[model samples]
Target: MQPVEGSDKAEILKNAAAHVAKAASSGSKIIVLPEYFNSPFGSQYLPEYAETLLPSPPKQDEAPTFYALSTIAAENKVYLIGGSIPEFNPQTKKHYNTSLIFDPEGNLLAAYRKAHLFDVDIPGRVTYYESEYLDSGNKLGLVDLPDYGKIAVAICYDIRFPELATIATRKGAFALIYPSAFPIATGSIHWRLLAQARALDNQLYVVLCGPARDTRGTLVAWGHSLVVDPMAQVVVEAEEKETIVEWELDPNEIEGTRKSIPVSAQRRFDIYPDVSAGTIQFEDPKLEEP
Candidate 1:
């Protein structure tokens, strides 16, 4: 979708819901939106756009986006990885770039705040600081998808870190989903490379849902939402436009790829400690709705 002005939060959500509905009607079981789907994609809009999502079942008045997402998921009978939103933590008095997951029943499954902040300066091309307005999250974005295997969630900058994807794969995630809004500078170079690297490294699927490129907007997102298969192949991709990308993922593809390569059973953990090892708590898969 094109970037909206700061005051167009309501319009943004409306457009997002319409797109989601269209995808669901087209037989999409799992849907994902792009980053900043309910607001503009810049630090200047974070203050007015931020909304509280904690205390689960947040008041509709407080977080209209939250309710809207939940309603759509339930109405469509699909799992929804709503793209990142500006979150205002009332207790800490800090803001965060957070992604929310909803089950088919409209229950809030998990909320993953962006762990890595995008603070970079390219000198001539681009310079922006996310830490100045948003705080990083400490937890990993791992969640189970009912009968299907587990899937991971991460925001734009989080995709740059391989550790997060590795950890999620080690914990049994079949696919990794990232809601990204990459600028033209980095997106043109590292966007596709990073997604392919993560999928090839883990022998799993990598799904990237990026906002549509908006030349008129201050922050022009490099829209090219894509999906990489377990074989590190670009199966389906969209151009730089407001397009709905729908693809079916097969669990057998992941299993077959791993069997052919056999990397999971041949890890050299004795040489270097596994990054996913240690005392860690993963979400209980049995807790998923049957």
Candidate 2:
């Protein structure tokens, strides 16, 4: 769930803690929160809300969102993906839209900053220039779970890049989890399509969590949190509301789909002469090979 905007850190943590307790009591082994769950969605206000990692001065008092995530993982004995947080990089004096993974024992497994910034001009309505306030990550982030195998983390706008998901799949991720707060305009056309495409292309489970509907009406999010199986089928989906969508996933499905399609084996990397060079092109024939 998206933590209410403009709420105090303490209040957000309390709500998250309670949610964790409820999920644990009902037997959920893993939970994913929406992107920027701790604060509202705006670049201008990020500096006031940004935080540093543990062992920093701000961490002495304990970051409410981080503390909540650790507590939730420990208390539930479940894996938790603390979606994307506005993390401060003191050296650069810039914030990173970051995602952190916690194991059942509250161990920090991996942290990933959003590599791709949202920079677009949407004509008349809304424009997001994420680079104005955030630094982009350079590498892929992955974590392993005992029962679920390896999982990869990607933030909101990252879903549009297929290469990110391809790299994760190549690195042995059985599933891809994206915590996003996609705008209603884009979400209506691209959210489910991207999710299904990634699953079908990589033959891995794709799980997405997003902010619930906003009655405040400033920017409505298309809230359809869902789990797509290896066959690119929606196993289950949550309504356009604040809720959880749960499903039983079989790790073996990845292997099964891979075995059936064998796309990995069929890749003709050697046949492509451009592999030796540093450039590859995607332009269609302009003159039709006449």
Candidate 3:
């Protein structure tokens, strides 16, 4: 979706619901939104737009976006991966960039705060620090969807870490979903590369959903939302505009890819330690019924 202007939170959500409805009408069982779907994507704006998303069904006044997402998912009867949002913890008085997942019944299944915050300083290029405003999420983002199996969820910068993807693969995730808002500088250079690398490394589907370009906004996002297959192939991609790209993923693809390469079966755990062997935190799929 396009970048939202100041005080347009309601409008942003309305458009998001419309998009989800359209996709669901076309037989999309699971839908994804971009990061910062209801607000602008910049560190400076985090505090201004952050909302409390706790206590299951958050008070409608305090967290309208949360309610809106639940309604959208339940009404459409589709699993919704709400893109990352600016979450404000009232008790701790800290902020987090978080993503919430809802089932077809509108139950809030999981919430994943971004584990890896984007903090980079390029001499003459891009310079930003998410740590300045937001706290890092410590837990892994894995949720099991009925019938379709499990999927790993992560924010933008988390995609750069292969261990998360690998762990998800070992834990039986068929796809890794990343809701991102990449600026033109680094995004133009590393967006697709990282997607392909993660998919190839784990032999799982990699899906990237990003906001469309907004020249009028403070930061211009590199809006090439794409899906990389298990073979590390870019099957479908969106340009730098507000559009939807939908494709059906086949489990056979994952099975066929692994059989052809057999890297997953041939991994030398004796030579190198398996990173996924250790204990990791995972979200319970039966969390917070509606």
TM-score list, all predictions: 0.93, 0.87, 0.95
Question: Which residue pairs in candidate 1 have backbone atoms (N, alpha carbon, C) closer than 3 angstroms, thus clashing?
Answer: none
Most lDDT-accurate candidate: 3
The digit string of per-residue lDDT tens for model 2 on 1-290 reads 44444446667667767776777778888888888777766676578777776343236353566766877898889899887788877667888887878889887777777889989878765677888878887766667777777888888888889887877787678889999988777888888899999999889999988877775645666788889999999888877776766777787887798899898788887775322234322112110110
Give me the displacement of residue 211 in model 2, in angstroms. 1.2
- Candidate 3 lDDT, 1-290, residue by residue in tens: 33333348888888898899999999999899989888886766777788876665577888888889999999999999999889886665678888889999998889888889888998877898878777888888898999699999999999999999999999999999999999999889999999999999999899999998887777788999999999999999999988888989899999999999999999999999999997888765532311
Clashes (N, CA, C under 3 Å) per candidate: 0, 0, 0
1 or 3, greater by TM-score: 3
What value of lDDT does candidate 3 attain over all alpha carbons? 0.86
Question: Which 10-residue window in model 1 sums to the lowest lDDT?
Answer: 281-290
Q: Considering lDDT, which of the candidate structures 1 and 3 is the better prediction for this target? A: 3
lDDT values for all models: 0.84, 0.75, 0.86
Ranking by lDDT: 3, 1, 2
* C-alpha lDDT of residue 112 in model 3: 88
What lDDT is reached at residue 95 by model 2?
A: 84
